[model samples]
Target chain A: MYEERHHSEILEDVLQFIYPLIILFGLYIILTGISQPGGGFQGGAVLVAIFMCRYLVSPREMGRLDLIQKIDKLILVFILALASMLILLGFREVIPYFNGIYNMLIGILIGIKVASGLTVIFYTFAFIEGGKED
Target chain B: MMPVVEKIMYIALIIFAFMSVQTPKLRRAVVYLAVFSAGSAFVYVLLGAPDAALAEAVIGSTIATIIFLSALQKYKAFTVYYTNEMRHEYRQSNLFRRRNAVLERIENFCSGKDLEAHIMYTTESLQEVMKNHGWDIIVRRKNNKFSIYGMEQNYHIEEMKKYIDENFNDLRKLGYEIELHIGWSENE
Candidate 1:
């Protein structure tokens, strides 16, 4: 069991400024992932770090994250279905932009999936260790 | 230019790896390992493997660190020191059999809450334990009566108190009373 530590007001104030920027940066990474060096996984990890930082600031108010877990699992199923459809269709040079659109959609889905999955994990640990009921 | 940067990255990787292993706290170690992963990802980039580098930077540095830190939390054991009024002989076999209903209830509560319960049947008094070693909960028994001492901020203990009061209401006929005392605990 871990005790909930009270952080200084300055720390919370600084986080207020920095937290939104971190989230914005994570979104930037996710949106530009297809063309840039970073992809869905890297951007998703950044998003997870944003959630983790909030917990670091205030362990008491983790809020409900069960929705995120449900969405994460739902996205996983969607990804599997999409992958199977792609294999079955066999888009062999028929449409040029179809491949690009497919990749972009898949990348977006993966990014959201990873972000929600990691956030749920963070909340789960925070629930047990920080001792917040939900 | 690339070779020089690659050489520096390799040296940094080695240092981070060494520091991670040698760090006293697991949290610090996780940070160092993340740095090590970042350095390795840079090295991969220099070697013209961007795909591998991206995977390394994300999975190895961020996701893996979070997972390791979460797993490390399980190491903090939830200790319960139970001291009976009459000191029984320290028999390894009978210790399990000698467990009272209250202790059994505590074990059940701890298990249901996912806390690793480390219950120790001690011969020492509560004052000695409070003044000496660190502990989460203390259960003392005196003449078929039980008093459970827990930290005031401990929600789990509060839940346990409610559980006992609700479940063991029938035990009043057996001349047994379970009392819960919540107060400030050391190391809070």
Candidate 2:
């Protein structure tokens, strides 16, 4: 509900310039998370920060919420199904190479799930004061 | 089992929590809360929970602060306009009379009700002040009589009217007059 600040032409240009780099870094974090310090939660948070910055700069340009919600739910169900299947198949008995592949797949799913969840929360909070759902 | 660094961190955490609650401005409080969260996140990391630390840093410092600040933007403001005589500007002859006393009273009232008080000192005519901006209360002084214009939409003015009438009515017997006007709607 904060009043929109006076927009500067330079800031928008700067954000446009650096946005791709930030997305690339976030993707790198998520993809390398299984063997690195960053993981799905951290990478998803970084990705959500992009949406936050976008809203801060231009509030009226948000896209469809239904699409985001659908993607989020789909990823969540997929993660649950995959985890349960692994458990039922006795995850400990899985070969090392297959485990690595499963780990990467699950990490990707979790990253997508987290990104969508945070996007939903941010959008809900942003528009709760009576703006359009976009 | 506490090292010097962790001991200091605990102390900082407690101090930040206290200051966050004690700050007067909502925005300042939010900033303090963010700092508190940051300190706690560091403690979590030191305690061998990087996952908790990351979640705390992201949700606590960034997103929560933004949400609180956005909510604070909708906080209703109470603005008071004090019309001063040209001479009173330079002649601080009486510090506790008229304008200052009224401002202090309003300040107390606002603090009690957790409202922000914006006091404006201007020599503009009452009509000009009312015409230009939205004001909750405008105190116009004219020949020993103070005309207080209160907007109708502000419910606080009605309670203020009762308090002022009760407390300042005795001053009317001393030859100074106080008139309360509470029916002016905005844009009219």
Candidate 3:
């Protein structure tokens, strides 16, 4: 499978060039989500392309999934905590410019959560489960 | 009118949805699903829901497609390597023609079992192929004898053994010794 992945040199070269651009685009979608059509979910899904592209470039190398999984769970906890603080505890009353800051913070957190969560899911399906057959 | 474009998108969405479900090959189905997702995203945009469109486009077309493809890589694909030892070039050999007839039967059996038959013709010696390649079955032809090497744990090979026994009884009567070599062990 690794040998088969190296069949196209052009794909590897082009992916190297396009990878950073994909990250930039995903980040753009995530950050500008407050005033734009795209939000955390869309940006996170776009970010998944980065890992997919990496797999395309080198099928043998399994990414740091444990770290991503950790990030996923940790971000989920943070989102819940932040949401509880804003809504249940009424922290919005305590802070100035709370709405914009809360929205931005939540969007960023959700973006990271979605990105890491999807990355973990992708790796699990692509590598972990597939590896069991071999 | 805008309604015409919306109708076209709806029709495309329905067509792609049906194609994704109806396709025999899993990879093609993933592609169809991606197209369906993209079409639905367009429809969402037309319905003045750009937010839903963005989400749909990214999740359906990008993430889901990758996940489906990854899952499919481990799907049932039966790999068979065919090597002719008596002749270095297989195309001109009489055994090659004979092997093709048997191969067609194996392919039919594979399809019946919902397995994609991935057959490769190699020039390597049996020992070299056995030592190097990852294969489900290796069909080797040496003169009139045919040796099929498979793992003991492979249930598909067991079914194939039965299939060959039932179908190729005529070939055995013609002095063609079809030997099924199992118990190769998992550790090479």
Which run of 10 residues does model 1 chain A get worst, by summed lDDT?
Answer: A1-10
| Candidate 3 lDDT over residue span A40-106, tens digit each | 8888888888888988777767878899989999999999999888778887788899999988888
Query: Which model is ahead, 2 or 3, in terms of DockQ?
Result: 3
**lDDT score of residue B180 within candidate 3:** 84
lDDT of 3 by residue, B11-44 (tens): 9889999998998766888999999999999999
Question: Pairs clashing in candidate 3?
Answer: none
User: What would the per-residue lDDT of candidate 1 be over residues A37-126, giving only the tens digit for each residue?
Assistant: 777777777778777777767766767687787899999999999899888977745777887788777887888898898788778776
Interface root mean square deviation per prediction: 3.9, 4.0, 2.0
lDDT of 1 by residue, B61-154 (tens): 8778877765755455677988875885467878767767777777777767767677888888778876776678898988888888888766
Judging by DockQ, tell me the better candidate of 1 and 2. Answer: 2
Task: Write down the DockQ of candidate 1.
Answer: 0.18
Error of 3 at A37 (Å): 0.9
A75 Cα displacement, candidate 1 (Å)? 1.1
Candidate 2 chain B lDDT trough over 10 residues, lowest sum? B90-99
Per-residue lDDT for B7-59 in model 2, tens only? 89999999999998997767788999999999999998888887778778877
How far off is residue B173 in model 3, in Å? 14
> Order of candidates by DockQ, top first?
3, 2, 1
What DockQ results for candidate 3? Answer: 0.61
